[model samples]
Target: MPRVGLFIPCYIDQFYPDVGLATLEVLEQHGCEVDYPAAQTCCGQPMANTGCTDAAVPLAERMINVFAPYDYVVAPSGSCVAMVREHYTDLLPLTNKLQEFQAKTFELCEFLTDVLKVDSISGSFPYKVGVHQSCHGLRELRLARSSETVGDDFDKARQLLKSLDGISFAELTRTDECCGFGGTFAVHEEAVSCMMGRDRLADHRAAGTEVLTAGDMSCLMHLNGLNQRHAQPFPVMHIAQILAGRQPEGITPVNSTDGSVA
Candidate 1:
């Protein structure tokens, strides 16, 4: 079993402990000895995305120092992983330490497919769903190829969903488009952000999706917030929770009268 450092995003640590828990369970179940270093902090994505690049410097150094020697550093959130992968160089000069950290770090899906070579799992998610390809995961992580490959490709969520016995996933028209939850982009450009989400939700509605699934809860949470405000409802799940075959342990509220009532 390869020893790994698990980097839980701040959102996952605070709001979505289930996602972090599922990540731990999934990694450990597959024989990776995972440890959460106490000193771990935000990957500096919030400040970086807010255009505060310099403010992210200390956070970046902390992460680099804390996890550099691990066999791998895995993160559940694609957006956070993308920050380490894409924006690390933006903060400071490319030193050997930076290079070493970048090489060892991986997004959850990327690690599962590339390093673990895990094609399938022994789990289940019994929901009809729409997959919202997070912008960072799609654009930054480069998880899928937009080519003429004639077969089903396994992304992190879809591949894990394949393990389920009765879950059905639908292919959307714009499969890998953004959900408009680009960190600070959600607040800075609310109209465009929401318009993009409404468009994504329209497709899910058309497909009669019971759940809107993605690797990043940030995107799902943004969309879900909009949905809640408008009294429109749908379940948003992190891929980790979906893969671990865990559901929120109770009846979830649903909107009855459209946007008029919750």
Candidate 2:
């Protein structure tokens, strides 16, 4: 069992702690020695995404120091992991330690599949699922083949979910479409973001998705806001939650009446 340092993103840490807990559950269940460093905080994705590399540097350095002792650093979020693996180049200079950190840090599914070599998970979800391919997960991490590229159909999320006892997937018209939650992108582009999110949800609804799941909760968070606000509501859960044997009961939905759900 590899000693895993669990890196929960800021949104998952603050808004959707359940997702973080589910990630820890799944890792440990699969024979990983997972530890949540209380000192852990945001991976500086927000600042860096907004062209504030200087502001993100301290957080990045701190993160490297905090998780250095562990054999591997894993996170439930692809975007956050992508920030460490890709964007750290801008925030910090190239060094042996930085390179080592980037190489070992992985998103939850990648860690399970690549490190653990787990092709199948002993879990089950009976509902039809629609997977929202997160931008960072698809593009940066290459967790799945993008629609823009012509290649064999391979999806890490689907691979694990397909192994479940009774679960089906919706063959979305656009499988690798972005959920319009690019961290600060959703805030700055609210109207476009809302429309894009609604379109993704509608695509899933048309394809008969009973439950919506994704590797990144930030994507699910944006979609769930629209999920609860819109007419056709469905349960939204993190992939880790399903992989950990937890059933979705609208875990990500907000009341949709106000901004009360923070």
Candidate 3:
């Protein structure tokens, strides 16, 4: 078993701890010796994305220090993993330590497929699910071939989900479109952000999916907020939760007037 360090994103640790717990359970089920550095915090994605590299530096350094000792570092959110793998080179001074840390960091799906060589999960979900291809996961990590790309194609996320016993994928019109939750982009451009999120939800609704699942919770949160405000009938879930056979609780159904799980 490999020595793995779990990197739970700041928002995931706070707002959606279930996702983090599910991630831990999945990794452990696969025979990994997992460790969580309790001192871990944000990966500085928000600060860096908002053009504040100085503020992001300390966070980046802290991540390197905490995760450096492990053989592999994995995170449930592709956006956060992408920050370390792609942006850390630019954020921190080029050092062998930083390079090693970046090289070992991987998104959860990528780690399961590439590192663990897992073909299937014991989890099952009978509902039709719409997969939101997060920009960082799809574009940065190459978890899936972009619709814009031409040639042989494969999707790590879809491949893993296909292994589940009763899972069915919802047919999305724009499968690779961004969900409009680009960290601080949603806050700085509220109208555009909400419009984009609603448009993404519209695509999912058109597919008649009972649930929406994605690798990034930030995107799901933005999309779910729009879905709730408009009384849409689906819940947004993290792929980790689905793959671990755990459904999120307290999420209101789309048609419910009040935000209460049905």
Count clashing residue pairs per candidate.
0, 0, 2
lDDT to native, each model? 0.80, 0.88, 0.87
Kindly report which residue stretches of model 3 are placed more than 4 angstroms away from their true locations once superposed.
248-262
Residue 257 alpha-carbon offset, candidate 1, angstroms: 31
Better of 1 and 3 by TM-score: 3
Report the lDDT tens digits of candidate 1 across residue range 168-203.
776687777677778888889999999998888877
**lDDT agreement of model 2 with the native:** 0.88
Q: What are the candidates' C-alpha RMSDs?
A: 5.3, 6.4, 4.7
Which of the numbered candidates is closest to the native, going by highest lDDT?
A: 2
Give per-residue CA lDDT, model 3, range 173-200, as digits (tens).
9989988889888988999998888889
Could you give the candidate ranking by TM-score, starting with the highest? 2, 3, 1
How well does each candidate superpose onto the true structure, as a TM-score? 0.88, 0.93, 0.93
Candidate 1 TM-score versus the reference = 0.88
